[model samples]
Target: MATLDIKLKKANKVYKEGELVKGVICVDAGRSEIAHQGITLIMDGSVNLQLSAKSVGLFEAFYSSLKPLQLINYSLDIAKPGKLPSGRTEIPFEVPLKPKGNKELYETYHGVFVNIQYSLKAEMKRPLLAKDLQKSCEFIVEYSNKDAKEKALSKPVQFTISPETLTNVKEKQNVPKFKVKGKLETAVLCITKPLKGELVVEQCDTPIKSIEIQLVRVETCGCAEGYAKDATEIQNIQIADGNVCRGIPIPIFMIFPRLFTCPTLSTNNFKVDFEINIVIVFQDNHLVTENFPIKLTRF
Candidate 1:
């Protein structure tokens, strides 16, 4: 029997556009030399999109033509037909990180309906009667430093949420009277850092049950005929569990989850965006929400 594995130069296996991805393919054969036909290494980067159940029937035509968008594809022959010596063997490989033709590379993101990934696969061709050996390893792609630096200069955003300022309220007379003020350190945030800010409850006629911050992912996928856009909750954090002090500020802090999140992206075939939701739940079970669209960078 034989075994195969891949090891990257960087322990984290993360890279940026235009960088070189270097790694080694390891093969272990018990005590006997293993026969092989040929060895090949392939690099692939793509974006896969799927329609949510809610939008199934609405985009039937679009779904039929949906396919994974290829950003990069490269293959190399690392070894010719040969037999591996007993024990262990390691073959080094280097592949350039570049997009195919005019296609642009997007940051690797793992979402419910959309996924962007990059991986390296090694294939070992075996004899006619022997089974072929295959191994795959995934790597992460991030935005360049230049893009991050440009977005870091954006100004901070301040906000105030009150019953009077609430929108889309059908029954305003039944709503509790309250005024909350807060400021986001910056609307343009770096994905590597935590989201920072603070909020204070100025006044409220009813007791509060909880105050929560919700991180949402907005994904849109489709063609010109129409696009199905969905906003799903990535995570929810309760900053205040009980009725908090009316004047004291409650610090707002949240860490962006890796893989589950990436720098906000938009393209012709699909789009990935993020938002923040401030939810105030009243002891009576009533709730009010304030939404804010945020931009994420890799700085």
Candidate 2:
């Protein structure tokens, strides 16, 4: 059987915008010499919207409600085909992966309800009655730059949660009345950096049992669906198996590992968010929980 393989020249598969994708298209003519049209290379990026809606009935058919938006669509004519020898031939090519418009390219993401994907295709066109031979490969795109880092540093820190300022949303069953205040060094932080903060339990209706600090990542599917999961936890931080009096402050710090977390990102279909979960357990089995959102950026 005949074969066509598209191999990226560089070993690195990860790329950013505005970079050139260099590769070679190798064609292995199976048995006899072949004649064809020109070779075409197409590169594009798109965001596919996926929805997790329940089926109407057991026998009802389902269709996708989301549509894919193209971020980049470019084609290159690698060569005007002539005649190829019976053996193997290689053609080198390079094409810019930049998007067409001023809109920024989104980072590659694979979620339950959304996916941002990119692919490179090599097509070997043949004459009439013969099928066109095609091959494709996928690559990753990350958004990173010096300017984004500078902006992240200069961005004001808005990480703070005060029980006194707690709104009507804090009402929950078996939750004790308490006033806790805390602040972080910065609102925007790199994944490599440690999240530093201080928590003070000013007053409480009951004795404090334990304190737990948790790192949570919230992945929302557009404005319709939202999911929250704990990425990490600092267990028994303070007042463990003990009680804390009023007017006591405890230091809080945790380094967000890159393994289970990603930089905060948002698109029209989905988003990822990082936050700090402050859970204060009372001796009476009551709970006081507060959460503060923090922005995470890539290094």
Say which candidate scores most in TM-score.
1
Candidate 1 whole-model C-alpha lDDT, 0 to 1? 0.91
TM-score of each: 0.95, 0.60
Tens digits of lDDT, candidate 2, 147-219: 2533457354433344555454455434556777666777788866887767676767778778877776655
- Which tens-of-lDDT digit does each residue in 6-37 have in candidate 1? 89999999899889999899999879999999
Judged by lDDT, which candidate is best?
1
- What do the candidate models score in CA lDDT, each in turn? 0.91, 0.69
Residue 229 CA displacement from its true place in model 1, Å: 0.5
Count of backbone clashes, every candidate in sequence: 0, 1
For model 1, the stretches where C-alpha displacement exceeds 4 angstroms are 146-149
